[model samples]
Target: MDVDTRHWIGGRRVANADTFEDVSPLDGEVIAVVSRGGTAEVDAAVAAAKDAFVGWSRTSPAERAELLRRVAAGIEARIEDLAQVETRDNGSLLRSHRRGVMPRVAMNIRFFADHLSSLVHSDFDTRGHRNHVTWDPAGVTAIVTPWNAPLMLATWRIGPALAAGNTVVAKPPEWAPLTASLFADIAHEAGLPAGVFNVVQGLGNEAGAPLVAHPDVRRICFTGSVPTSIKVGESAARNVTPVSFELGGKSPLLVFDDADLDLAVDLAVEQFDNSGQVCLAAVRMLVQDGIYDEFRARFLERAATLVQGDSRDEGVDLGPLVSKSHFERVDGFVKRAVAGGAEVILGGGPNDELNVATGGFYYRPTVFEGVDRTMEITCQEVFGPVLTLQGFSTEDDGIAMANDTDYGLAATIVTGSQERAERVASAVRAGTVWVNCFFVRDLSAPFGGSGRSGIGREGGTWSFDFYCDVKNSVFAPKGWN
Candidate 1:
């Protein structure tokens, strides 16, 4: 695919001295040559954004919302093409992109656009004083997005920043950098002001570090793994910039003895979505002892039937890992787990059988049965199509086991009783909890993580709160109106 994978600054593509090949996970071939950004590129993008922030920050909420609406329209108008590219770029299911993700990307922007103008900013009287709260737009924001679900995640941060009237410089993951350039083109065509939205593509240390640590960057948003988040946090700390992170997860999926067996089994299988690359998927399952054997039997039967192949195939259920290195990392984790006394109940590893037939990083859906919280596989985020099973006896045991992990991003509870669902959902220390369901999201609800999983929330008013400065102006009550 011929794409302009260059740094976008001030509404134009900026050329670079160094370049990197963007490999397609679909077939392990070079799809595009992306311009590699360095500190210089980051500096240029930041300068552009800082210059644009003056006018953007001064714009009325209505005007910013209208522009965001246009950006949403532009994205939807070319949703098919966007989905196709994302599939080839990220090695995810095209059907999923066409049906769900791409639509949500546009909606992510549209929701913020429509709601920013109707925000609940009100003035109230207290002690003969009328006080009005204001959401003031921050200056330039640095957004570093991950390779998995790049477009969706980037827009999740970008939409709110733009709607809040903050100019942005996004450093997209070099592994899946194509669509970010495409997104920049759409924004420019939608008539977004120059430098309001910029894309700088390169290695983390070279480009990402400079962008996040830039003194002029007022806000930083990062979404990636735990180790990488530490680096980002350190860089942002130097500038004392406010940052928000959506990091790794070892989230738990709980099944009570009284849970509907069919529902529990189905939800357990859904964890393999995106080849278990999803951060929000609860891959570590803690099941009640009474129904443990039955759940395992049903889960194994369904998991074995999952067809792994190239993502371009229409009926294929699983796709390759995002890259060669990621596949090795996941495979190594499985091997180590098996050696450490965890029994592989199902798939152990791919023997390169699928990759032999087709070129790419392919692994079978794997499950380990004899898993314990003491094991690294149970505690660490493998970020693969690997599930670890551990049986718990009582409700307290299940909750304790679920909360054992250092990460608290998301969790799932599958149960028959409403009381149990409500109780467990409340007790679980996660940013988002689903009862008898998975991946069902409402845009208005607050979405973020706790502990090592992340720092702040970014949905609806939570997003505005992150990208804006909340202030109150006091006035004389009688003369204010």
Candidate 2:
């Protein structure tokens, strides 16, 4: 297949000899071809960012915030176009991406922009003392985003970094570079300085590693898998460069005996939104034995009711996996779970009925029954719309089971008692615990994982602290000195 080599560099589309194909998962069709960048592309992007950083980082915070506001406007203006492209590119349901994801992300950008405009730096009132603490830019950041929710997560990192006066050489996943390019274009149109935000498109081994390890690159903000995050950590360690990783999760949903079974079932189904591709999605559903069967039956009924169809189709609740490899991996996990003796309580296997003429990569929304905490299906971050339902004998057992995973990204607890919700939420051992909902994220909330899930937070005002550094100066006043 002939591939197009259009790479986003310094806010413009450039071409090169190398290329990669953008394949559609809806029918395994070649949608477009993207440039496969290499060391040269990485070096160019970094050099541009480094050259621009001196001036861009020195820009007034209000000016930076204004630029972000314009970018947000640009995004809103092209929301439909972006939503359609994202749906076609990633197999995300168009309605969900438009109604749920894009609007939320755009709102986040505006929220942060307004916050940045209103921000006032600390004042030193130490009786004429020169000693004070100051926050400073960390230079250029390498913002690497995953293929899943490419634009939203990228802006989550880039927005704060820019707001903190850090220029960026952003690199989207080669497999999904168009959205990154679109964002960069929007930023440029918003009157951002030339070279302030550079984007590179290429594979991880070639473009991504070099960008992370580049001496001029100050901090690396990455959102991807835990294993890949470790590799990034290794590279960052070698250079002593700071890194903030938003990685994997096997998040759990714990339903207490006194919980509203109907609402629990509703929230449990929400866990599978976006086909459970989110890193913070609740993949494990743990119910107290008293209500396990009831919750299980309700949850499966809800799951079965999901309308699996093309993303562009109206009223389609689910869509195909992001790619062929993703489909295969998800299929493998479901098959392996059955092989490992977990019973399929509801929908399982592939869905050819949704798009019979088209070879859509659709996996049936699956639920595994009789799952134990130690089972692979329960412990692994499957990253699919597959939930493993397990029953716990006691509240303590439920909490223990929820916390048993290596991940501590997010967890959900369903209970009517405020005290029980608070206690269980606190004891769940996850970074963010939803008392009665699942995946309710906000701009002001600090979002990140603990343990093996991830390294740093990515939202709210707290995220700004992650992209910059603070220096404390201790000294007496001139008279005292």
Candidate 3:
């Protein structure tokens, strides 16, 4: 398909004077020439959103829900096309994008639409005075989504922000902007009003900075790294604009002696599903002393079975990293880990043996043993197909080790005993804890992290709250009046 790589502003594709090549990581080929927008483009998008907010914020909930449903239908109809674009742009496996990510994008839109009615205002009486609480749209919201899982994360922010009657100025990562632009097309086809949704395509320093620092933007929602989020937060702080961050993670997966060994091993291997590019992946595995040896053997056996090849190839379990730089960064982590006294037990470098038409950015699924909690390998967010295994003596020791990191995005407890599961789940400092499962998400559940992982939450009512402002009104009694 011939894609018009341009910025989507005010319901139209706008071209910038300068452009950059959208390189496909799969084969290191230039896929498209994307417009390189800057502060001017961001200003235009924000102005458009502000102008549309007057009408959009006044629309009734039912009307907004209808438009969202239409958007969801449009996405569902073009899932295959979007999946292909995403696979090419982000280096994700075509099968995973088609069967996993694209469906969630559609589901996110529909889920927020169906749950709109639940964002209710409260009425109560306090000392014979009637009090009512209400919600209002928080002006123009600037949503900056990351390259990994581009469309899905974009929809995660857009669905709730739009459902709450807010206008949006979105900045999709420069590396993977095609699917996001396609999503804007789908929204326009679904009858989204001009400027209600706008996308500014450019590098973060040029376009994203202006959007976050814009005085007209009331809320800033960002999904990316911790260091970047700190800068975003500082920029928004100058204007006192509310900002929501879904940052990185060094999340842990704890396996107790009594756990379902097979299930634990399966989840441990599945951590490399998206080439370990997932923010919520279980990169740190903390196993109990009694079963650590056995678990390590089983996990290695499973990890060795992963098929690393071209994303478009069928039965390929792992795809290339997002870019050459990322591939190198992951490799550097492995080298450093080994130098730091960690043992590389399995595949630890790029896979060059795959038969492909052209050169691609590929890495083998790497596993490290004898990883201490304080080691850089165990503490840092590798953001690759690198897993670090550590052993713990007791349940308390396991929980302590799990919460030792600076990140608290997610964690999982695998065990047969419900009491043990609950105990560990409650003790872990992470935001979302999985019991006997991993990456099993529900739209209604609150998702986000504590401490350095992020601030605030996304999903369901929490999302609605973040995207809106609450105001309360009180009525006086007749005698008092």
Candidate 4:
């Protein structure tokens, strides 16, 4: 593990001529050096996938399903190892990865694999002709994952794409590429065919641009920031290749006066569990006037109890942000918000009490008040453990404030009244709405956003459709032609 991390291409470990340091944000140390794959590596991966596509696509559904099941089992067996690597590489709390992320990864793969048997074709009979509708693999697909949840998110694309019988060439974010290598190992152990799945680790501009723009790649699925996704889309557009995006969000968490205050406070504090680096984190809170003050008090009290330190610490609840650059970015956002008259009700900067020798990129969970809807901090994505509080007088006002952002990835409503919950959930313009909870997800449900959040969905049947192309065949009896 201490050696340089190489690319997993064409069913083997391939080393590049150049390498880059894989720094750990927790200790600000070079944990490992990873291959800096570029156009040549991307080309090799795509070519390998193309060469494997015909045979992989021709594999029976049962065979593919079995392979997927084996992969799932392999992931389960190596859950601890995968979780440790992810936590070390991404600066996520080890407990969070062990209990939350790793299990979800295995479940996501199995969920898609189990559904393969039910993937059926359709038939239609006319007066003189019989027509059939079938789903075919979209050849080779390029999957680009973000640094936040490398393995989990990549599996969101990889599981379904492989289940649909398409070969894959994946590019894990340069920041956290360790678990991706582990995932490739598990896939090979599960008896996946050579060239069916590949991983190229490097910077986005160097490796990602060429992969998306490659003429041989039929589809692209990317999870990252809005700007990066736009660039990915433009590249895919040139070749007329389809692309699916799960982009940024400034998600709102609505706390009605009638909501359970304790639960609201607990969930709000939970936002800092991953230091608020999640795309679906409830970064904005719209509380009713009656409960705004009390909610803010309880939220700050709870957030204060969270322990911030190195991700490897078992007692820590909030770990450092992913990298030094991300730490500076989050710090800058807080500074700007304060300058705009927003009050730092709880935390405003890094936690100095933690051992400095850790050298981690730590940021205390910050809570801000008096934030206006038009302010940059309110409308833009900070992608940090910073929450902006706004009070709403009416239900309409709350809904308006929630949908004010350009991004509509996800939102949550914490209300005791069933009618209010139903009404507000319908009114909010987000892809996923949690009625009484935050970050609750089901693999069967569609997950994506509207208006800059993302381009398409990535769960259950939606995933199946995105990874496959449909074809219609007709048969005429006698002289029907």
Residue-by-residue lDDT tens digits, candidate 4, 1-481: 4423899999999998888888888888888989999999999999999999989999988899999999999999988898888888999889878888999999878888898887776678898688887778999999999999999999989999999999999999989999988889999989999999999999999999999999999999999999998899999999999999999999999999999998898777776658898999888988999998899888887788887887888988888889989989999999998899999988898876652768888888898988897788998899999998889999999999999989999998999999999999999999999988888888889999998999988787888889999778888877744
Clashes of 3: 0
TM-scores vs. true structure, each candidate: 0.98, 0.95, 0.98, 0.97
- Checking candidate 3 for backbone clashes, the offending pairs are none
Q: Which residue pairs collide in model 1, if any? A: none
TM-score for candidate 2, residues paired by index: 0.95
Query: Per-residue lDDT of 153-250 in model 3, one digit per residue for the tens?
Result: 99998999999999999998988889988989899999999999999988899989989999999999999999999999999999999989999999
Candidates, ranked, TM-score: 1, 3, 4, 2
- Ranked candidates (lDDT, high to low): 1, 3, 4, 2
TM-score winner between candidates 1 and 2: 1
What's the distance in Å from true for residue 320, model 4?
0.5
Clashes found in each candidate (C-alpha, N, C closer than 3 A): 0, 0, 0, 0
Model 1 lDDT tens row, 421-481 = 8899999999999999999998889999988999999888999999999899998746533
Distance (Å) between predicted and true CA of 239, model 1?
1.3
Which of the two, 3 or 4, has more TM-score? Answer: 3
Per-residue alpha-carbon lDDT of candidate 2 for residues 1-481, written as tens digits (9 for 90 to 100): 2222466566566778887888777887878778788889988888888888898778877888888888889889888877887787788889877787787667767877776754445656566655565556788899899988898888887778888888888878765667777777677778888878888888899889898888888899988888888888998998899889888899888888899988998888887787778787888888898987788778887888988878898888888888878889998989888998899987778786754667778888888887776678888888888988888898888888888888898888899999998788888888888888766677887888899988877676576677778766766656542
